[model samples]
Target: MDERRESPGQADGAGRHREGEALPAPPRPPRGEELGGGGFAAEGQYFLKYDHSSYQQFRSWAPAVLFWAAVLCSIRFPAAAAAERSGEESAPPRVRVVIAPTLSYGPLWIALEEGFFRDEGLDVELLTMRRTAEALPSLAAGEVEVLGSHILPSHMNVIARGGRVRIVADKGHHDPDGCTSEAIVAAPSVIASGRLDDPARFEGLRVATDKGMSGYFYIDTLLATLGVSAEVLRTFDLPLSSKEAGFTNGAIDFSTAAEPWLTRLVRSGTAVKWKAVEDFVPGFQSGVILYGPALLDEDQGTGTRFLAGYLRGIRRYNEGKTDRNVEIIAEATELDPELVREACWISMRDDGEIDVESLVGYQRWALREGLIDRAVAPEEFWDPSFVRGANEILRSREAR
Candidate 1:
């Protein structure tokens, strides 16, 4: 592997990332605070390394000695921080994860609050970004470690070219037979006009998309099946929080929404649901877990542990909208507990798999529409090794 990595993109005239130009390296922390010394960058995935001596003979027996020690001691001392305080152990790996504020971030939020990440021996810091696209640059430059966001068309330019970021796991996606996870809604006037069934009527229509177009995949895909090209419609990028206002205030005639926003708006009668993303493209991946350089290139052990923790969270989340899950999601997202419970819950894979076929199909559509600069092969952007390792770890732990 080349020691030097490439910057993914620079802003074009239209403010879109254009590949082949460089983004400046992210600002570095002061001495002693840099990432390298934290041990997370090169820590063992399954075990802590407390042995430092160069005795060649010990190499044969040390791994066994240490493995049992870890097994025995781990029960008594759950934190790697305890070992670090003895002055003989390396610091525990610390991960800074960026998550968008929504129900889609259920796994990460659950993991953070439930101590799953800590159980995996990781010190994790959670950061929330309202518009996940704004965090891509920092993520590509490794200023941030992991991200919980949707798989956007624009981000393909970065992942396909630079290799600094990766789609490691599924955050959330539309379940075709399940209650709506994402939908396209039309204003009452548009619905009343009955032009919605006429493909030609979509021309010059106004639409509101989630800011950064993360959730636009649902709208764009749903509309395309009706023979409406995205170029024919005028689109506005509004925050998820602002979609209701945009609909009621007539800022947009059609818009895309995710639950519980979908439920909230529908109950409020701001707009009527026109289509669900899954209705058009079944099992379409909407939300994803991204790995920046820290996890993608520098420390896969931590990445594996991170995914393992996240999978544990997924299992907990898959337990349905139990009172515990409802409370955690409500507190984390600040949605009303009643609304959270009333809303159609989102679904994700228990094993952290991304829907590659759906992803590739979306990429082809994006390329055909001139919506993205490049398309990536599944292997180029999605790495399955971490998920495989994570599952193995979970199985081993369960056996014990």
Candidate 2:
């Protein structure tokens, strides 16, 4: 092996200098200048050298060292920041993760307030986006680091468009009933017509959807099963937040949405639950953790650290022994604590671990829904190494 020594005053990103350079001799003070030297060194000695040749040599090596130093600093910043940020503290790697504001997003809440994210070295800042679709695009565009949102369709569409994103982990899957995120609802007109008692009555009623959203696919699947065709139910593009009011105000006869909007419509009596998507598609997961591909590809170390922290969070979240976890979720999601508790019962898994079965199911749904032109393999969208590493970390802790 070639033996190379690092020069004195030469530092890496961690601020560690080499012992290769020569030390300067001690100097005598002029008179009584208050002795600036510290306790470690004698009164007149200087820690740094000020020599012409030495300075020139440093300049020669400085550019390359500085370049690599920056690279290392970028990689090390998050870990260092994570170390400094305690549960109640803030740090550089403390990412501001945004999730849709709803009861379904309770697990993220549990992770944050329970100190799971902090344990993972993340200073999580959870924000509730009224519309996840609208929010996810920003994450893809590098406006944010992580987002908790529906994994299918939008995630696929993003990948198709060449956005650097991957579904590293999953939150919850469709219940045993096969319902995923959206619940099918009929407008007051359809519900009040008493025709709701008759399945054929919905044939000609207009239904509003986000057009390309999972809700749209849920409605399509429901209609196809019932022998209803697209022509029978007029499909209109509508925003989810606006859908409830539209259905109640007689603008549309049917619509699909996620809770608490779905719950709100049912509670307010503006609409009735027609069907849950999980009724047909079982083990369908929702709310995935995504990061830009560039980060993973270019900065492998930082990317690894990020995933390690993420998995650490997952490990902490899996220890759900009581309602304390539920309360954490409630506060994070800003939903009523009672509603969160109820939602938490059906929601599975708090960690960002991927459910293989659910991912395949979702990919199948996207394929069937024509969201993607061709059948893209599930692995194309998922990177399992991170999840596996997280599992290993947890297993190691258990072993210890």
Give the per-residue lDDT of model 1 (tens digit) for 33-107: 122111111111111122343233235545755664455455435445565677666545767776655777777
Model 2 collision count: 8
Clashing pairs in 1: none
**Model 1 misplaced stretches (Cα beyond 4 Å):** 1-90, 210-214
Structural similarity to truth (TM-score) of each candidate? 0.76, 0.66
Residue-wise lDDT of candidate 2 within 1-400, one digit each (tens)?
1111111112331112222224332222221112211111111121123345534544554565555555555655676667677544433353435555565555555545445555655444554444455555656765556666676577777776777787777656667643234567887666667875666776767778765666666676677777776667777887555776787678888777676666666777888887776776556665577766434465444444555555554545555425676665555545676654443233455345566676666567668767775544667777777666666666777799
List clash counts for every candidate, in order: 0, 8
Q: Tell me, by lDDT, which candidate is best.
A: 1
